[model samples]
Target: MPLSESTVLISEVGPRDGLQSVKSVMPTAAKCAWIDALHAAGLREIEIGSFVPARRLPQMADVADVVRHALALPGWTVMALVPNLQGAEAALATGVHKLTLPVSASEAHSLANVRKTRADMLAELRRIVALRDAQAPAVRIEVGLSTAFGCTLQGPVPEDEVLRLAEAAAAAGVDEVGLSDTTGMAQPAQVRRLFTRLRAALGERAGAAHLHNTRGLGLANCLAAYEAGVRTFDSSQAGLGGCPYAPGASGNVVTEDLVFMFEAMGIATGVDLEALLAARAPLRAGLPGEPLYGMLPEAGLPLGFTYADGRLPRTPSIPRQAAA
Candidate 1:
């Protein structure tokens, strides 16, 4: 089947997911600047930061401020990660454009990571939806299904469990449910099957695929997901992130490589390769000495490499109103 529009959504997750894994705390100003640069590169949606406790993740201490700064940028969807109802309320208070709630498919991993069972997570989702609807119905709610493919604590997670949680999240009132390869254990075949089931279960409500490159199959899994009709993909700038709790896991898929793959395939991701690579400046400056990963920046783009018709991330002609 031919792609209808030849375009895809590449969501930058470096601010939230990437920074949370590393020890260095990027200043709020640097974060805002990095986000602004990413937007200039044509990225429409970016996970600015997670609304977690400062004591836990000091890297995102100024998430509220970051939200304000990001919303000021035109043609950007400023997204924040919220762990529970409290985080959701705080994020809502900041008037973020989008909020994500994470739920794990593995019961063991869920309990260990968030100290909540899958059932408990579902119940929390219900409360969160009520709060969001009553208080900020305009803010989009996405439930990120972590460990949907596999888990470090429990090993292989069941597909039925993943699908069940996705359906429950959709029913609980989340606008979308995205799959996460939290431990980097997903394979191409597995990605295809699970994403197919996910889209079938939720239709357009099936959101992004947040894949990791721990075993070097991140791109393969992403390709599989794309083939299964997933349009939104989450990647970290310079591939600078991973699950801290998942001991052996590596970083999230590299934004440059993912963009290169899609655009090279004659599919438009709307992300300018050179400009996106330049956003790494803030990332490197913010976390000096921290190892950044990616093949494109090191190798440089191919001589004749052209973007999907050499197009940049399409910015809307009209500026959007900030979520108030």
Candidate 2:
């Protein structure tokens, strides 16, 4: 059966989420090139990088520079992740179109990841939202209720608590709030239920679905969220990020595969699956020997596969990348 929804936003997160977890560092110019290619392929919103301190995440040391380059591109929404009020301020200074703050619903994960309790994180959200309103009201603030599905440290995150946080975030003055399966513990049923409850709680303020492909259910969970009325999604190109459950394990749902899923369903993504796949050239070149993963690239499109527009990828010719 065809999906009821006809449009979806595949927000690319490989620059921030994917690179941060990887040991190798992609150069700043290469990062800009990758972002350019991504935008060229029709991804409107791209999480170009994060605003954390360089000592903490060296891979994102030149975030401001990358953001500057992305800003120059026309018709693209530049997004960056901020860990707290401080990072949020820096991200705002970059004049980014969007800023994302991740708060873990799981108490243990909160303490482990950000070294703050859930209450403390909420407090930070309050302060960040206030700062954003006072300084840059034009910039959109997004709060990701991270680890909502389940936590690697605490496990079994309650649905009520997740909904409560979403309410709190909405009340805290954020422009939007979304659920994140940081540990890839989200099942399809859980996704549908939680998204429905979140929509009930926050109404139209409920935001994107940031899912991990851990255990190979990323695409399934995304579909479930879509059926629940979600239109925006966060995915890493080539599945570049790691799984928190295994600490250094594989990545988020592959962007190429996710786009393929939506386009194959007659849903419009506006992304050229072939061009998006070709964008991986810069990624591989940036992080040589990093071992990228994706289904579309390996198996190739199955026989008779066609995009939502009834067109196939431009060509089977592979994209070439500059030496790292």
Candidate 3:
């Protein structure tokens, strides 16, 4: 089913971004189960995995199988992350609905994360776009300006550079460009200003807000993004991941808490909070003994709480991160 105009599009990245940080590989069957549960809970867009070398990210070795499984689900938008033209080719072959690439605004981070200078990455983006235009014209390509706010390796990314990259990405024929708080150095003030500038610069082509909860301000930054007219968001289930390349960059905005915040404020997230909370079970089963983050699971919904669309509340049930 198509989302209503008021619905906030939350792209769940637990399977891709979340798993890439972990050492243990989640069994293929378990990954499918977790994704199935998420889809059942009304999450329409999901980044199932990345198209990287298995030796580098063994956790995602079964990405193609995961994509095939996710594609079987009706009305689901299955996305995948690709670091270069090579990765993009693999993802495109899997028939993914969308492909997201990370382009850092910080020069140091660009080298560290993708081993490419900003200009090289732009060249890569153009190559990927050309390939998509020829091979899979229907697939959408999105670029996330990673380390847009700040960088641990480089420290304090400039706003002008970020906007410049966004313009470059748009000019490269990407469907959209969004800002990512890759190192979790963003404050609410900074988030608002950047996203506001993003909208002003890219208009409808401005994409999701991929915020991190590293400093415990994930929700605050998310709200700031919303207030700045950002409707799409990228979150991880159970707050499962962060940038493995970004030192000390831990925690993604928790999907459960994010959904609750929007739903409680009379904003339609279109996610069934109870169902979303229940999806945590499969994740836990997949990664035994892994510590999950998110306050909504630990604390049940408040009394008489109602969703934005007037969905009645239910009593809740409950449920992080490490090396690159």
- By lDDT, the better pick of 1 and 2 is 1
Model 2 stretches with alpha carbons more than 4 Å out? 1-4, 243-250, 316-324
Each model's total of backbone clashes: 1, 1, 1
Candidate 1 per-residue C-alpha lDDT over 31-95 given as tens digits, one digit per residue, 9 for 90 to 100: 88888889988888999999988998899899899889999998878899988899999999989
After the best TM-score superposition of candidate 3, give how far the Cα of residue 42 lies from its true spot, in angstroms. Answer: 0.3
Model 2 lowest lDDT segment of ten: 315-324
Q: What lDDT would each prediction earn against the true structure? A: 0.88, 0.86, 0.92
TM-score of each: 0.94, 0.93, 0.96
Q: Which digits, one per residue and each the tens of the lDDT, describe model 2 over residues 79-181?
A: 9999788999898988999999888898888877787898998899899888988999899989998889988778699999999888988998998899998
| Deviating ranges (above 4 Å) for candidate 1 | 1-5, 311-324
Residue 173 alpha-carbon offset, candidate 3, angstroms: 0.3
Give RMSD (Å) of candidate 2 vs. truth.
4.3
Ranking by lDDT: 3, 1, 2
Top candidate (lDDT): 3
Candidate 3 local lDDT, residue 265: 87
State candidate 1's TM-score. Answer: 0.94
Question: Candidate 1: worst 10 consecutive residues by lDDT?
Answer: 315-324
